[model samples]
Target: MTDDKTLVSRVLQGDMQAFRLLIGQHERLVAHMIGRLVKNNEEREELCQDVFLKVYEKLSDFSFQSKLSTWVATIAYRHAINWMRKRKMPMTDLAEEDHFKAAFVEEENPESLLSDQDMNGFVMTLVDALPPQYKTILTLYHVDAMSYDEIGQVTGLPEGTVKSYLFRARNLLKEKVKKCIGKEELL
Candidate 1:
């Protein structure tokens, strides 16, 4: 496996091919990570580019004090939050009511991969409805699958805080999803 250290070191040494390799390795991961923070599609894509550009520009400063993925992820997280904050939406924790599985999504048919798309779409709507904080954390947790510690490093919060934010965000999304389902049933 071409580890992050090797790739980062080579790229920092001015290896252009290594840059491509690094981008290939990290582009989707970075995009997905940032995408969770910003809701605007065009802006998200632009921010994704900006995130990589920042990563490239700052490549030399990388001391390998952390893994390349973490370093890059930190960049994405910071910039994504910056963009959100600039747009006047900072992330916040959700209330407890929405956290339980019963509120947002009930268990579904086990044999039904066919329903996955619809379900995911429904979930995405709930996710998008979250406050920027919860949206960002939830996106990082579920979409990027980063650990609490890693997310903390990225967001400049403690690991415990990251976990709390995630919990609150999930609850908020669950509440929204539940409200949406109820509204649909009423119509």
Candidate 2:
């Protein structure tokens, strides 16, 4: 496995294979960032492609100040945000906790009555309903195993803000799961 600096240097020199390698390495990070926010599969796929294209175009500008993955994630985050803005989607701020909680929790649906096997999918659905910032931070920290600082680099939030959001996001999911479990017991 080549180091990121070597791979980036080769890509900057017009090495197509190195560029492919870069894409292969960071593709999951890009997909997870976009997937957490964008619901449409086609759009998500296209957005991932666009992110790499932008990476390639700007490869020379990468100064190695951050890990290659973190830089790529930043691009992915910005692209997803721009896409959402263009579509007139609500970019809800995390400060609106009451509004977020009210909108997120609702009457139990048929899908919420899941057996253990379906619990993972049910939890993901709850995560999907969260605002984009919360979803992005959760995905970056948990799915990608990134540190709060790395997540902050990607999302342009402070480390403290990242930690706060991650904590709040987990708490929100916990409450939702507990609510579902309590309701399931009544059935």
Query: Which candidate tops lDDT?
Result: 2
* lDDT, residue 131, candidate 2: 80
Per-residue CA lDDT of model 2 for 44-91, tens digit only, reads 999999999999998899998999999999999999999999999988
Off by over 4 Å in 2: 98-112, 183-187
- Residue 178 miss distance in model 1 (angstroms): 3.5
Pairs clashing within candidate 2: none
Going through the candidates in the order shown, the clash numbers are 3, 0
Clashes of 2: 0
In order, the Cα lDDT scores of the candidates are: 0.73, 0.86
Worst 10-residue lDDT window, candidate 1: 96-105
lDDT at position 98, candidate 2: 62
Q: Model 1, residue 29: displacement in angstroms?
A: 2.0
Error (Å) of candidate 1 at residue 114 is 12
